[model samples]
Target: MTESSLFKRTAAELAEAVAAGEVSAVEVTGAHLDRIAAVDDAETGVHAFLHVNREQALAAAGEVDAKRAAGEQLGPLAGVPLALKDVITTADMPTTAGSKILEGWQPPYDATITRRMREAGIIILGKTNMDEFAMGSSTENSAFGPTRNPWDLDRIPGGSGGGSSAALASFQAPLAIGTDTGGSIRQPAAVTGTVGVKPTYGGVSRYGLIACASSLDQAGPCARTVLDAALLHSVIGGYDPLDATSIQQPVPDVVAAARRGADGDLSGMRIGVVKELGGEGYQAGVERRFGEAVEVLGKLGAEVVEVSCPHFDYALPAYYLILPSEVSSNLARFDAMRYGLRVGDDGSRSAEEVMNATRGAGFGAEAKRRIILGTYALSSGYYDAYYGQAQKVRTLVTRDFEAAFEQVDVLVSPTTPTTAFPIGEKVDDPLAMYKNDLCTIPSNLAGNASASFPCGLAEEDGMPVGLHVMAPVLADDRLYRIGAALEQALVSEWGGPLLDKVPELETA
Candidate 1:
């Protein structure tokens, strides 16, 4: 395990090595930091991270080393480096939520998951960039700038968690945290050839996560492998009394499930092919790759069948309504009187005027667009017609999932309709951008567990395609099972992880 190759090891492998004294925690952390320094700031680099907590990360790693040296037992992910999305609050670092409004705002406390990661001895490398307020499909809406796909520098990494996905794909970190309001986690993973999981809503505590759509927002693991994501998932998931909506159930044994799935046997499992999630608009290569993945599932002895979730057609529209309506209410806290950015507050303008100026200047275009859309949907006159109706549609989508699950252990689809699209291609086309979440939104709407696993590269552009898996609310282990099976088959076929094909980034 030479230092130069340390960044390429999975979190599981690194943790095992560190625990066995094969490598010091500082050495592991330093390898990642060195990797970040070498490639992250290059002229055409990934630019995945918004901030790198060099001193804090190294110090945390040192503490882990001390604990290990003292013969104390450490968590499974101890000494593993992780990239956290900017939306999650970190007291020591800024929690900007990728919007200029919260830029440079230091949080008062760590997000529950953040604290959990520290407790597990996971070193927080830095905050990754995202779409402002987690409102866009591509990271182009990030106030700082877009996160370029590591697959092709000119392409968009899936957003609002693009930074995390990019970090994994570029080998800057072995693990990362991402929030999926719609498809923020899964879509990015699909585009970048990484693994992302959106745990069941309320499965992971959201105490310090900056609100997106409170009902829909979920923070989950992002990694290069199914097992690695599951390992991270186990550490951050469980009940948190601080979060009112936190589930009161024990976290599922996802790591064990992932390990079990690696045997490549799904003899008794039943899988469903989502009829609504693919077809007419789906790219040829995506559909082809998805069909092949489904075939692989069949070869693994799983019963594959097509299931119809008819209401899924309306998921995009309903999601836009519900998400924005919630966004309108949640974002109201950013008024000029409190923390974050302030404008025209030099003791002259009225409070309302100050708030207007601050938000106008602070929020990026997409954030403003969603806020207005949400406000309009929730407005007195349109509340019943827009927001209320959308809620009804949401219920139907949940019913669709319920009905589908009764027939299958898990549902599958192409995570995104297409591969990574070129940046600037759809920034001005909001509707086109929103379409990216078409397949992923149904799960968020229903608050079920979902994830994206790298299946293989699309022939059209030679970019990655993700196999999306949706499981019942508490049946998150099912997702990892399916993902692990696919991952094992795919890795064997590709001769390695799909990300191994990514072109090497030039070091600074």
Candidate 2:
């Protein structure tokens, strides 16, 4: 382990070193803060973080060191620093969700996951940026400006969760928390050469997550390696009474599965390749890398076969309708009458007028577009024609997943159709932007566990390509098992992690 560049180490390694008294938590935290200050320049930096809680982070790290000094038993991830997606609320930090509506708003209470992280002694570094209300495929929708892909500064980092991915890729943080609603987590991971998971919908509580689409939204761990992600997943996932939708069951033993696979064996695992997610529209390089990944799985002793999920073709259209409908409702709480930004509130103005003004000023174009589309879809007679039909389609997609799961333990596909596109390339093209989620949305509709891990870099643009693996609702361990196995194989083949090939950025 190289102590000089602590930022390059994995979360698990950092935790181990800290727990062994090889290094103090405050030292680790301060080193990361210093790195952030050096590289996260306003003009050339990745701009992954929206806020950096230097004071609080250092204090938390010091507390961990004190606890260890007192001979207290610390958790597995104790002293490992993490970046929180702005979509998750925090009592100590501001959560904007990349929207002006909630800018500078700090909640009085911590989210369930936030509390869990604290209990595990994981220092919350600060909030990373995201799409406005978690609505867009790219972080371009963020009012805070976009996060640049570390692979290529001119390109996108992937969205709603791009900041988290970007932060990991740039070595600003070893771990991050991301919310996946129509691929916010996985898509970013796919493009940035990192690992991201979208656990079963209720696997992690949504109590403090700002709603995007209630039924589709899920929070999961993002890290550089499968085992690190699994470690973070165990720390954050479990039942929460505050979240009515939270699963009242034991969290999967992802850490054990990851360790098993790290030994590089997947002999009895049955992996399915989804028929509908590939071909025509997918970039050739993405397909090539995905094909190589499948071959690696076969050599690792896993059975790989193609399975059709016909209804997956309709996932995007259905998701667009259902998500906007939910967004219209969930985002309604941002009216000027409550917390956050308020506009046109002079005595002469009516509350309704003030609300209209506030919303008009606070929302970005993409958000307004979705709100209008959602409002129209849920309108009197059209509800049955659009929103109602979309729900039926959602059921069909779920059924497709259920049917496919019976034939295989896990399913595989390219996490995204292509690698990261240049920033501003699709900002004005809504359809092109929406297409990015085609490979990732079905799992959200089905409420299953899905993850993206670096397969290899696409030859065309030299950007990362992710191999997506999905498993049934409580079978999250399956994702880590395969991911860890594949990662080990790829690492052995390449002589290092995929991010090792990334071009070095000139940090300040």
Candidate 3:
């Protein structure tokens, strides 16, 4: 295949071809690297990566080729090029969460997913950028600087996982890793016109991922197609003894479900349209496109019904409270004396002075904002009123999802209220910006499987609109099945990925 053809194929398609001996792993890796060289330096500079493992990737691809020659057993991802969000630890590369504090710090070990991806023989592309500590909905909060949107360079690529989404959308890489606490993974995918799946919280092990909002943070897949996402998800999901919350059982066969969906079916699924998320704050085109997605599922012989989730109204405030509190606790590990950036005089400085200088210099404004908010919420008399009450609200939100799931197999909504906005649009107004995640935070709090795939393009802005699909916790494979089915249906009508038809940008 030509290098551009290699860039354009979905991760699964590339993997399948490689596994079938139609192509060698080295050629594919080379093509991807060439594509990254061609565009990653330019105007739609996705900045998807914080570090590029050029030598490591080439070495891995070479080994894959040698293994096949030796007639060794091979995994499906044997030749695939993929990225790890910098938050996921990798012994060979730095694992900064887009923060200056940990800028050049490499972990001594790999995360469960990072290890598994390596075992599956996927080539390591690099570490992608993200919001500092995965805190914001836009990568503008990243210490490495914002990842620009590929569709329109002036706009955002989405946050927390913006770099991952932008990487795949721009064909810099066919697949990448992302951690979603609130809407980080899916929202970025929605805006970038890619597929991102936030597997049921704890579906993927969190032992080595940097903590964000601990209860809500989930490392998931971002790719060009639903089946590609399924391929990566299936490989990464399952138990890890090191992660306390990991489910003890093997991950259900998510890949098989995607294969089943690709067979052109969705017979008896009960897909619920959440009544509360459809109107008001949502943009006209978002709701319009979601309505069309419902229609697609209906045509595929699935029952789609509107279900009410009244408790969702309280999800946003509760999330901000809970996330900050966890962050305050998790970030304490970054104190200057222990690890990361250390500031102040080595011998003369007091412990408190060192910490203050380190944190003040290392942390971005958003990180500081959340840490301050968290510290205050957890302090003295205010603890009972803020953090405690937010926990109660979290419990209520979980119950809300349970109630809705009882009536429907999977819940659906427009992924975000709108398409990608200008890069700096929401960064200045913290509260107004956090509201961007209003539709997304509830599912994260509930510890469920959520997926965002392009439903259609927006009429007003000609940007991609995403439809959110969710399933109960641990029923993750079902999400892949339904998501793949819907993806196939939508593609049948719209032809191919929304970005394919849009004009490509001139490089810087």
Candidate 4:
């Protein structure tokens, strides 16, 4: 098959072809490397990847080809190439987390998730761009520069995990991995018109993910289709001894759920419409599309009901307080005495001086801002008034989910209040940027299985609109079932995936 044709195939299709000897893994890997070269350039590129592990990727793909040639059995996504989010450690690749602090630092060991990918024979194409320390909503906070939306070059791809989502939307990779500490995965998916899942907090191992908020962060899959995500999810999800929070249980049958949903039946399924998630403050086009999706679900045999989660209004404030407190504590380990970037350490400088200088120069503006806010919140004198209160609010948010789920199988909302905004539009506005995660944060705070699926395009800008679905923790299969059913219904209406309608960028 031609390289172009190979790039267009889904991860499952590529794996099936390789297993059947219809194509070599090397050819598929090479096609993606070529595509990355075309669009991931430094000057006029999408800036999706911070580093590309070209040599290692080809070597891994070749190994898969050899195994297939030897008649050895392989996993479902064995030969599919994936772009990993920078936050995950890889012993062979530079994992900077999009910050100058750890720039060019390669970990000596692979993260559990990275090891799992290799064992499954999935090729790691490279580490994609992200917000520095996963702090900001827009990727413009990256020390390496931002990842542009493939659909609209001037606009932002969703933040923190933008690089991963953009790589899929641009057809640079069949699959990608992302971490959602808040809306890092889902928001980017919403804007990029791709699929992203934030599995239950402990559903996937957090052993190798760079910590943003220990309780809130979870690594999950990003892909072009629900089935592809389900396939990747099965490969990555499971218990890990290294992660204290890891759940010791079998992953839900997500692949089976995706397949079942493709038949488009939601009979007896109850979907809750979050009352606070839509209406005023949401974009006119976004609300219009969400309203239509609710109607469509009704037509598909799903009983749709509006449910109120009042404490959700406090999710934003509570998240900011809790996340920064954790950030301040977690980032304290990056002292100049250890690895990563060190500045002004010419021997003449004292250890304190060098440490202060290094951090001053290493962290970006947003990182510094959060660090300070977190430090202050965590300080002894003021801890109770701020950090302590936020934790209580966190409990309320989780309780809200428990009550809502008691009444419905899953909850639905607009993934993002608006479509992709301009790259620099909200960079200077921290409040505005934080507001972007409004619909997505409650799920993170509650530690549930949540996903964003492309619903339709906004009428105003013709950009993609995503329907956010949240299921009870450990009930991840519900999200896929609903997403697959909704996706099939929408695809039939739109004639194809939304990414197919995205305009190609002009080559420099």
Candidate 5:
């Protein structure tokens, strides 16, 4: 392949080519670096990355090339370059979590996934932008700036992990790591014409991953194709002793499942259409595209039925309460006395004063809003009325999932209520922005495996719409199976990946 075209290859293909000696690891890594320079930093750039580890990436690529030359066995994703969300700690790079408070803070050690990727020979392109403390639905809350959708520069890429998704959409990187706390990973993929998975809670380790909501946050793969995502997923997923919540099970054979799904057969699979997740608030085009995808699944021989999870109606409110409650506790560690940003520390003020001043200046509005809301919810008199009640509601949601899964192998819905909305269209309206995750939060609340796959473009605006799939915990492979089946069907219809329809970015 020509150097310029290397950026267009999927991670799996690139890895195979490198392993077969068709292209050196350095060449593949360089092609991606060159692509980032040309599109990410251009005048009309996607602004997806917060930092680009060019030198480190090439050095890692060189190491992979040396290993290949020595006839050593390499991991399946060896030599593939990946964009990482800023929330994952890297010893060599700053992990700001898109917040000014932690700006320039270099982690003392790498995140578990970061170390795993390095051991597997995956080159780290750099840290991508995100919502401040992973708090908002739109990337607009990022302290640096919002990442633009590659499909439509004026529109928003789905929240918190938008930078990672945008990078994939623009071909800046073939694979990425994104954390999903209330659809941060899947929702971004939904908007960017990409694939994103939220592995079952505890499916992937949380060690060194900066917390959004400890119970809700999960790190997962992002890619342009479901098979590519499954390949990447196998690399960074598994048990980790360092994370107290890590599952003690082995990672599922998602790659094999994806390959099986690529044959486009879902015979004997029972799929459920989430009755509560669509309709009233959904966009006409989004619902239309989602319905079409469901029909395609039926054609693939999957038994389709409408299933209702009634408690889902309360998920949005319950999630907000629960997430903020955890955010309040997790963010407390960032006091001025600690390692992050400090303020009012000239020896004349008390530690409390310094912490107050530091947080006042350092935290963005959304973070502060959540902190306050959470504090209030957990306060003396209101705990039962808010936080405790939300927990009960959460239990109900999980039970709903249990009941639904009893009758179906997996459930499906429109990933979001609508396609990508224009940037700034809902930033000022927090409720509007929060609603973007409406269709995705139930899976997180229930700690089930979920994913977003590019179904097709919405007819009204020609923007990509995602089909959300949810499976029981530890059944993450099921997500890949369904995503791959739909991806194959959709790619066949579109004559290529949906991202092929994206307008080319201006070269630097």
Candidate 6:
């Protein structure tokens, strides 16, 4: 492959070249870094990266090259360049989780995924932007600024994980890590024309990831190709002693399943369509594209059946309550007493005042809003009416997923209800903006495995809409298999990657 083209090659292709000694690890790392440098402008502005650790990256590349020269065997992902979301801790780079309160704070330890990537010889490119503490549905809430969509800079890249998706779509990196609390990975991937996966709750270790909503948070891989996601997932997922919630089982062979589906025709794969996920609330273009996706899956020998999760109607409200309640609790540790920037601590002031002053100054408005909303919900008189009831609703929503998965090998829906909206459109309306995650939030709530891949461009708007494939909890490989099958079928049918439709970037 051409030098200019190698950086854009699929993860599998890159792995082959690395294994065969056709490309040096340092060369590949440099190429990706050059690409990142090439288009990092206000116009092409894929503001995906927060703090890039070029020194560490180059150092890692050198070690990989030395290993190759010594004839030492390497893992499948050796020499790959990967992006880390700010939410995930890294020893070399400061982990901000896209909030000013935690700015310039580097952890003494690496996140489990970060540590795993290093062990597999993958170079860390940088930390990506996200919603402040992953609280918003779009990256617009990022304290560092929003990551513009790779497809159309005028619009948003999906939130929380938007930075990772933008980086992959822009060819800045082949593989990246992103978190999904409420469609942060999948929705952003959909808008940017890349692949994003949310493995089952305990599939990927959450040891060092900053908590947004503990029960709902998960870290997963994001990439341009399904197999690339699988590779990264394999590297990062497994049990960790640090996270009590981590399930210590071997993560199924996600890459193997993806590769198999890449070649295997989608025969006998039963797909259940969630009636609640796509319909009246969906944009016409989204619906049209989803319909085409259904047709494509059907033609590929997949049996498409309609399934209903009636409790889905309550999902949005329930998630808002539960998430804020958790956030209110989780963020309490960031008071002036410890960590990051502390603004207001005077010797005369009481502890509570210092906390109030510190939090009031450090937190952004959206974060403050959620904290207040959560406090109100968790208040003694309202706890039963709001937070407690939301927990019950979560159980119902999860049961619906269990029942649906029993009926089909995988469940399908539009990754988002609409294509990417203009940057500021929903920034002011939290509720309306939160609705963008309607199709994706349930998966996080239920702790199931889900993958989002581009289906086709939206007909009315010409923007891309994604098709989501979700599987049972701990059956992450199933999502990858189904996603890879659909990805290969659609890419082959369309004759190439979906970003071919994206407007040309006005590189600096």
Q: Write one digit per residue (lDDT tens) for candidate 3, span 46-73.
A: 6778888888898999999889888988
lDDT of 3: 0.87
Q: Whole-model lDDT for model 4 versus the true structure?
A: 0.93
Tens digit of per-residue lDDT, candidate 4, span 1-508: 8887999789999999999999999999999999999887766778899999999999999999999989999999998999999999999999999999999998988999999999999999999999999987779999999899998888999988999999999889999999999999999999999999999989999988999999899999999999999999999999999999999999999999999999999999999999999877899999999899888888889999999999999999999999999998999888978799999989799999999999999999999999999999989989999999999999999999999999999999999999999989999899999999999999999999999999888999988888999999999999999989988998899888778898886554
Which of 3 and 4 is ahead in TM-score?
Answer: 4
Q: Which stretches of candidate 4 lie over 4 Å from their true place?
A: none
Q: Tell me each candidate's TM-score.
A: 0.99, 0.99, 0.98, 0.99, 0.99, 0.97
Q: Compose the digit string of candidate 1's lDDT tens values, residues 266-382.
A: 999999999988879999999999999999999999999999999999999999999988998999999977699999887888998999999999988888888999989989999
Clashing residue pairs, backbone N/CA/C < 3 A, model 2: none
State the weakest 10-residue window (summed lDDT) of model 2.
Answer: 1-10
lDDT of 5 by residue, 1-508 (tens): 8976799999989999999999999999999999888888623689999999999999999999999999999999999999999999999999999999999999999999999999999999999999998888779999998899999899988889999999999999999999999999999999998999999999999999999999999999999998899988888889999999999999889999899999999999999998999888899999999999999999999999999999999999999999999999999999987599998899999999999999999999999989999999999899999999999999999999999999999999999999999888988788888999998999899999999999888889999999999999999999999999988998899898898899988888
Tell me the whole-model lDDT of each prediction, alpha carbons only: 0.94, 0.93, 0.87, 0.93, 0.93, 0.87
As for lDDT, the candidate ahead, 1 or 3, is 1
Candidate 2, lDDT over the whole model: 0.93
Q: Residue 227 CA error for candidate 5 (Å)?
A: 1.1
Question: What lDDT does candidate 5 reach at residue 271?
Answer: 97
Error of 6 at 282 (Å): 0.6
Minimum summed lDDT over a 10-residue window in model 1 is located at 38-47
Consecutive 10-residue window with the lowest summed lDDT within model 6: 38-47
The list of candidate 1 runs beyond 4 A from truth reads none
| Model 3 regions more than 4 Å off | 42-44
Supply candidate 1's per-residue lDDT for 27. Answer: 96
Q: List the residue pairs that clash in candidate 1.
A: none
